[model samples]
Target: MLFGAIQALQIITFEPLLLQCNLWLLAGIALFYLLESGERTNALRRILRVGVVGWMFGLVLAAVQILPTLELIPRAVRGAGFDFDTISSWSMHPIDLVNVVVPHLFGDPYTLDRADYWGESFHRGREGYLVSFFLGAVALLLSILSFLSPRRNLQRTLLGLTLLSLFMAAGEFNPFYRGLSEHVPGISLGRYPSKYFLAGALALAVMVSLGLEVLLIHEARGSRARRGVLAVAFSGLICAALGLGMHAYFQSRPHNLEAWIESMADPKRAAAKNFPVVASQLNQSLRASGIFLGLSSFLVLVSRFWEHPRMSPVLLVSVLAGELIPANLRVVPLMSDRDVEFVPEVITYLTRRGPNEIYRIVQLDSPLQTFSGIWAPNRSWAWRIHFTRMSGQPMYGIMSGLQYAVFYSVDNLNTRDSDELYGRAFRLQGADGLNFLGRLNSRVLLTTSEIPYPGVRVMAVLPTNTDRKLKVYWLEQMSPRAYFVSGVESVHSHKEALERLSQPDFPADRMVILENSGVDTKPGDEGAGNARVLSYQDRRVLCEVDAQKPGYLVLLDSFYPGWQAYVDGKEAQILRANYAFRAVEVPAGKHRVEFSYRPLFFYAGLALSCMGLLFGIVSIFWSGGPNGFKAVLIYLKSRHKKLKAKNGLLA
Candidate 1:
């Protein structure tokens, strides 16, 4: 029960890709159980039954988060899976294997400027998906020693898994991984193939522990010692040769320290111009790694000469601590509150102006601006602002807004409708784009570039310590969060609506574009309607609408599942409006409308979870006072036999 709950909790909190790790651990447990059992056949069957049942129970326990996620996946951009090129990105290059021993050969992204990271998968200010994959020189040597130990079968299994993980980590470079990603069912769902390196790292750690046990406790002295020394010597020679080659390559670059330092100030030029710094760091890392390697190798050789094998643990621990601790420290970047905390004047300006108003703001600056300094200027300030959701390029949530006029990258978590609308909205710049922005209820736009559109007031020009200046523009004709639209333009489908939106004169401010054959909630006067948002909360929104005749009350929020609309005391159907927003029909008078989020899947999942909890409790408390599983099985068998007899009598 505990195993099932823990596994369920892991899936609930993190990506489903973590199931791969859980599977590996489960396989290990099964193998250990089989190895220890005298009656292997019976043990295998029993353990398999228990494991399957436990896995199923885990799914039930995780149903709460899982069901909602399952509902969302179909609407998500990556629901089906990613393309091979996208999924295989951030794969570990075969050349990056050197980093296992010489960590800073490519340079550190966190400790130094991200530009200093001269490695693969560097794009849009992100140096790499993974920065480091160092497993220590001592760990590597000990892992080699594990192969020579008596538990050759276990060692072989470890070696196979470690190699397989490394091959998978190679991703695009490996033909096998490429084939698997194309043909396999779930392989394409995972991104960043270099993440598989963690599995290899885990395997090596286990191997090192086993190797230490063989050396210290088992005392494999003569032949094992000779083989270990030979293996370390051969590996050390190869690493030394690789280091020399790298040194020669870095040596060819021009070393103009002052010039490189000056060029590092420019974010765009930093990566190319800062090669000298990277080269210098590489040289230092090489020297330091060589020293550690030599020291550890020396200790291993001396341990063979030492009479007492018990001292082997001391030397092993010392070598690992000396090499690994410093590498660990160097890879992690520490920041104080001053480094992360800052509020820009633009945000302060927005907050001061009608703080209670229900509206959203978009930051139009490029995400690469984060590379301007050690960190992005006032990036964390986005968290403090209410109603206004701010982000640059890598928008997190579904409602991070159509901040960018055109998404330059495909990293956004956008619906097909919103993506189409935003893409076309960029082409419809000037008046049309402004109208669309107004329809989105975008009141303020903070950008590095200046806006040249009409009715856009220059709110402020925020000067920062760097060369860049943030220009804040406020839209004068922007609509409120909730408003009554007298004119509702109906189309057959999202495709048709998108085609219509692409036109030069799409009047988004005066009318709402909905995907339907005909709109019934039309006002008698076509202009006798006014609506305002009474209150806005995370899960609910209240609005008051006044109309001379029946009309549509449109809310400029995402038309998502689970949100229900009610008109006064009666339930109302929420309609999809303005490509991806929500709307409901209101009668010909003043009335209050409420929208509350209460998804069916979430409630169903909760019920299932409660049932699971009850079963867990009953299993713990009942079933013959001891051996709960056996008692439950016996009760199930008796019930099955009774049901069989009753069916025979009925027949």
Candidate 2:
């Protein structure tokens, strides 16, 4: 995309604004080829041979990568470490099972929004389908142009370069370059430039075929002049290959990798905490300039020894092998699935809390970099792939509205002793502010305790005990002006905060906040005949409900061993693992939203999507055969054979 964008700008543009955002980088590069012609030379065969030699070098790199991959190396680059833990992927299958009977599940997003969770994914599928079709068509055309173009003027050379750029671009941007992300926008970058490495393969193929043809036409004869450039390129390629190899090896090493992996084995561990630090260490070595510099330096050193053909090819091939190896294993270990001591209480709170309810996710930055490695790993010293694992990089987190709107670093988890962290800062202004308020999920109360700002008054303790470890606190303060603004952002009024957390139904006998705790099995049921008091975990709770359950109790991974859940009074099912939260199956009715981390079912949905995708791709492409165009003929032939088999069976 970068190359394409660059090329597009070079061409005519009535307005410069297009260059900033709407520019097509790849298209410009394609046009660059159309305008240039090959230089005529009698040593065509010799030129072809050189190109072929370069390609063979690429093959050697591929070999290096393939050997390890075939051996099942855990850190094998290309297709390794693909994660899709986002909201869109998990809610699919569970929604589908419910929708199967509902029948009103399929529709456009606007219409389907009311259907349920499953409806949204398929509805969104329409947009994704369109995007994928567009992307596939573009990839196909680029591939064809490179494949069919003659090797003269080294048209293949330019084609190879463009292809490399596009591939590298894809590798950098796409989540899983070959599989899932191919359908998305330009891929993000990583530890290794995948697209560029893959392009090297195509370049090798081109160079080899052209070189062999040239050798057939003319015997090998050449004066070794610019062996320097060749040497430098070869060296860089070699370093890249070796660097990635070492990285993968160290990252997957038994001692280093196992320690992190073991950490995650505990259900109490947060997947974010157990990230591999060794991977980061190696990433620093694989820095972009490292390869380029190493290669260049080596070439300069070996420039004097390049006269012999045998020596030259061997040296060049060694470099090529190095480059190819790293190129092929382009997977970057930006994050790993490791375990950390997960805050159990936090997870419980999130699960128990209703949907869209807000809560502060605090990280204390004073003693150390809290949540630093987990949220983002330090890959700064590494090569600048467009997308890298930088420390504290803003993440896309989903828990409650707090995860959505703003992330707090100086919020409700700390204490300022007796000196007043807020009072000292605001004393210069000479006036105390009104007490700030945050409506959970709606307007968040921006308290001095929560944000460490100027105006606040001491209130009391929450969860009512020091032993519980809840970050809740009590405070009173004022700030009509400060409330108007908090930091660079504005703050809503007290009334607004209450309104945010309150239901739109206005006056209620009592505010019925429907939490998607997934604890209650009977969704959409009422609060009719239920026990008034119950006890669990040394706490007394009251349950009141009607005959019709009218809410979503999605107990995502809220499973704790031996834990039993009841709605109103009836016991619910504990269908999955002990620690994992389960979403309670709601009965039929107009309901509220509550959910938990019942993920095993989500994985089942992903499996189904994968199967569907595989089927679709295979069915569409199988008929395209060796000739590449006779899809219809192949289809007819297969159909005929199937029909014959059916007839024989009947007989």
Candidate 3:
């Protein structure tokens, strides 16, 4: 139940990629159980049965989140899944393997200046999925030692998984990954194949633990212990040699060193101050790898030479800590409280506004960077790919509307709730695109560039730390958050409505484009009716509409599943208006029109979760002995068959 909750919470609160990691962990456990041998077969079966039951229980526990997610999946940007090129974009470059032992082979941005580091992908206008794949030289040595251990099944399962993970991380570079992506059900659901490194890292950690067990139990003076020591020492020599060789190869030719620096994304940096720092980074990392390996070798030798049982474990732990501590520290960039406190002037101006009305803000320049890393294939190239770091340079001055109550129409981070039809309307180029923002109730536009369009007034121009200034513009033509539209244009589909909205002449404020027919949108007084928002919450919105004549009360919010409309305490059908917003037909009188999120799928899932919880409690009671659950299942099946037979005779 806890695991399922964690998985569901991860999917809801965090990126789906994290849930993939949890699935991989489950796969590893299943593999471990499947590889079990000898007289433990019956025990393994019982354990597997419990695991299966627990898995189902977890699913039921998470059904509330899952059901809503399933409903949203088809409408989401990635509903159709990702193409091969996109799925494999951030795969680990084969050369990144050096980081397996020498983590700083690619200079860490955390430890060094951004321009000082030169990773492989950045030159190609791409960034790696992870900063480091360091498993520690001690861990690597133990993983190697596991091959010689007597537990064949355990060794094979872990090592095989580790190897497979490496291949999968290779992504497009590996034909096996390509085959798996095409044939495997869940493989295509994930992107950035380099993330598979987590599985390999986990497998190696487990193998290290197992190797430690073998080392601790064996006689220090025994032949097996000696062989293990020899193996460790030999592996250290190889790591040291590889490190030295990398440095030596670069030093062999002046052009090799120059070419390496020149290949960086920033050519000016390559020629200027960053050249020497970039050149020495790899060399220093190699030397450090050699130093670490040599130290591990000495530590292992001391553990072997010493007769004490605790000596081996103590020294091994010390060696592992020595390696891991520094590497882990470099993973996170050190920042002062001042840096955290620093807020852009533009952001400060926006957040300091009165809370009377709710409207969205659009960051015109940095739409791609919105939500941090949610990318869609259908998204325009102007909305840059998430993998590209723009040559390690800061692209935008202020990432607006990320956290504050200020919402953004185009780039606010909620991925599933985004309506593609409305997105398509906004993604239309030139003036047509900016026009759609008004329809979305976007009042303010935060941009680096000045808008040439009419009615877009410059509200404020604040100087930023960068070369560019942050300009805040007020859009005068924007519609209210909730308004009553007199004109309703019925369309056949979302495509037709989108096409109509794409035209600059479309009066989106006074008119609504609804896909559904039979809405009693009686011709309203063009300028008579008024709608005032009484409340606007995340899940619910209440508006008082005084319609002079029956018309549509159009709410400039994304029309999604579970949002119900009510007029004067009576339920009313909400029409998909203006490509992606909600529309309810109001009568020619003062009426309370409420829009509330009450998804049936959520309630259905809640009911299932309750049932599952009750079933789990019942099963716990029935689980009287080791084989009691199995016996209960057998009896239930027989009883079901007998009841079926009696029903058939009655029929």
Residue-level lDDT of model 1, residues 1-651, one tens digit each, is: 887888788778745345565566567667767776899999999888878888788888888988988888787666778888888888887767878877765675653235566553333235556677887777877787776677765676677668867888888888888789889766787788788877778878889987777666443467755766666756765675565555565466436433443443445555444566776887777766766666666666566667887686688778789888888777756544443344444555556753356666656654433433533333232321211223222333323222333343445366655566666666666777776666667777767677887878877776544345666777887777888866777888877766665564666545677787366433234466888888888899999999877778989888899999999978999988866778898888999999999999999998988898888778776757557766878888999999999999999
Name the best candidate (by TM-score). Answer: 1
Candidates 1 and 3 compared: the better one by TM-score is: 1
**Per-residue alpha-carbon lDDT of candidate 2 for residues 1-651, written as tens digits (9 for 90 to 100):** 222223323322312212211223333333344435263343454445543553343323233233333333232222243243211221222233222111122221111112111122332322121111011111111233233233444654445454544443343244444453435432211222321333333444455344323222221323332342344345545655665565566556636644543342332232322233323432433443245335534543454455643453344345545643443233222323321212223344444542332222222112122222222232221211111111111222223223311233221221211112223222323222222121111122222124355443222222311222223222232111100000010113323322322323321111112233334222122232121112212222222222133322322222333345554345665333111223233343422222222334334444544554454455446655664336767777999999999999999
Estimated TM-score per prediction? 0.83, 0.29, 0.81
Off by over 4 Å in 1: 35-37, 111-115, 120-126, 218-271, 341-344, 354-356, 369-414, 502-504, 517-526, 621-651
Misplaced by over 4 Å in model 3 are: 1-24, 34-37, 40-44, 110-114, 122-124, 220-225, 238-258, 261-273, 336-344, 351-356, 367-430, 518-525, 610-651
- At residue 439, give the lDDT of candidate 1: 63
Kindly report which residue pairs in candidate 3 clash with one another: none
The best candidate in terms of lDDT: 1
